[model samples]
Target: MLRARPKGRPKATDVELVDVVVGAPDAGHVRVENLVMSVEPYMRGRMGGEATYAEPYPIGEPMLAPTVGRVTASADDTVPVGALVLHERGWREHALVPASECRIVAHDDLPPVVHLGLLGIPGMTAWIGAERIARIETGDVVFVSSAAGAVGSTVVQIAKLRGATVIASAGSREKAALARDLGADIAFDYHDGRVTDLLRDALAQVGASGLDVYFDNVGGDHLEAAIRVINDHARIALCGMISIYNAETPLPGPSNLIKLIWRRARMEGFLLRDHLDARGEFEAQMATWIRMGAIRPVHTEFAGGVAGAWDAFLGMLDGTATGKAVVPLGTLGAGTHGGNDSLDKEANR
Candidate 1:
């Protein structure tokens, strides 16, 4: 659990690993042996003990996260023993979860870890942002920030599938290359130069006058750049602001707000929890895309079981992770049914 509210960037010591006794579940609950767990950027905000879309983690309690596991013992017949499940009880090897809260996952054809990455929150988030929020259209020129990361990578492919010309930016050259491989018509490293300048060059290279859609994963400079180049009636989906997730104080907003008015553009921030009603629709679409080889899962797996969860979290926050940062606890293979050769190759790198 977190020792206290972090003063600046959170440190390893802030999260202590203490042994606790695990009791048998009640009538409606089951004991899950976690197989794979996720570490995402939003989790940083939860540790701040501030009011947000999700409740903050308690000062000295187990940190909750997206986890895929199997039921070792179940009090409810609906959720049988050895059944694979998805729940939010990560940061620990085992947890007592309500059977009602457990979503039984079918992993016979796919890897169980896919429930924590490509077919889970990240994939759904991308679908919501690209299709619903941004309303990507054929021939539209789209810009995606953090295009090598989990949600951004998915957004890139989705926008491309919609027949949009995709431009992307990443923190490193290697990540930028991955973004291009993911179907970005133009991909550049944000560190190469000023973001606004790079974006302008990318747009010119693609012969696009301005952006029709912008999927923002990094805020601050990236948001400012997007606002500067948006076409009339453009839509921007604010998925995350990873650039400022660790900031100790509030950062300034985009300086180009007036451009939104001039361009008649819309910028909206969305949380995944608010869009749960569309999960079934999103899952069906993404599953088909995965089967057709139109979408590829991207993730980095840490291999120390429960002990590696913290490292995975830190790696994700520090931009060392390419897509989703996952930690494997039990012996669940992270492969995606032997389909994603590119994903397998990237993982080896």
Candidate 2:
């Protein structure tokens, strides 16, 4: 990201993929050639030159993300060469990350892309929001906006696992069906009409008074809708607001917020980094869920390596991706033996 896209939506033309030579690792660092890099909606905030929970992305420097790569060279004993590792130095072909910061991957039965998808940051975000923040209780009525997306998809599944009836909304009918396949009790097309009416209709069909937890990814109208009909003491797990992330001027706050005041409902925003203490538990539960066929991750892979990264980022932010979008960089996963064609077909199956 060379310059901030302050005026309008960020475009591929705004970023420059300038190459730089890589040197040997320092005493405690390991050089990792990224096999895959993630393109998520949160990156939009970092590149917008605003000070939020995350720092503004530095111009004229390599952008960063959670990257999975093989240790080509290492000066640390714990992370030796040839080991598959995960770190946060993406946006370039290779990164020299601190040994302590990298985690050794031991996955075999599952594809490595899971490190960037269901078991990755998005997965963690989903779990933390549903379990920790929203506390989605059993039999609770939960609504997740952007339910076909990486985080929202996971939230839909997790909410089901916790025995909640999930009402999911997506931009299209296909995505809504995807959410239905993921076990949502009701899935609707948010773009076709007013989401608040659709939600009210869905709840009327279910005979529920109001939603217990509104796990929001697409904010705007969705937030307003949830605010319109929340149960007493309901929770709004404020996650990504992708609908408003690229907006130049501030959108209006929900008019029905007085309902929150009247119902004594709570809306709390969270960052995944703020809840690292629960990651180990989350990983264990996610692994078991994957093993027992409790969850299936949806993923969209970009084969254009680093060059197509910008378009992939824009595509995901623009909500074109069928699932969690990522750029498959260097060699596929360590044990995974396949070309780009096979890799693309293998994901989300």
Tens-digit per-residue lDDT, 30-108, candidate 2: 9887889899887878877778888978887777888888888999999999988888888766778999999987463
Residue pair clashes in candidate 1? none
Task: Please provide TM-scores, in order, for all candidate models, with all chains considered together.
Answer: 0.93, 0.92
lDDT value, candidate 1, whole model? 0.86
Leading candidate by TM-score: 1
Model 1, position 195: C-alpha lDDT score: 97
Each prediction's whole-model lDDT (CA): 0.86, 0.84
lDDT string, candidate 1, 1-349, tens digits: 7777776688888898655555678999998888888999988888887877788899988898999988988999899998989999988777899999999975336787678877899988999898889999999999999999999989999999999999999999999999999999999999999999999999999999999999999999999998999999999999999888877778999988999999999999998888899988888888888889999989988767666677778888889988878888755534322221221123221
Where does the lowest 10-residue lDDT sum fall in candidate 2? 335-344
lDDT over C-alpha atoms for residue 268 of model 2 = 96
- Residue 270 shift from truth in candidate 1, angstroms: 0.7
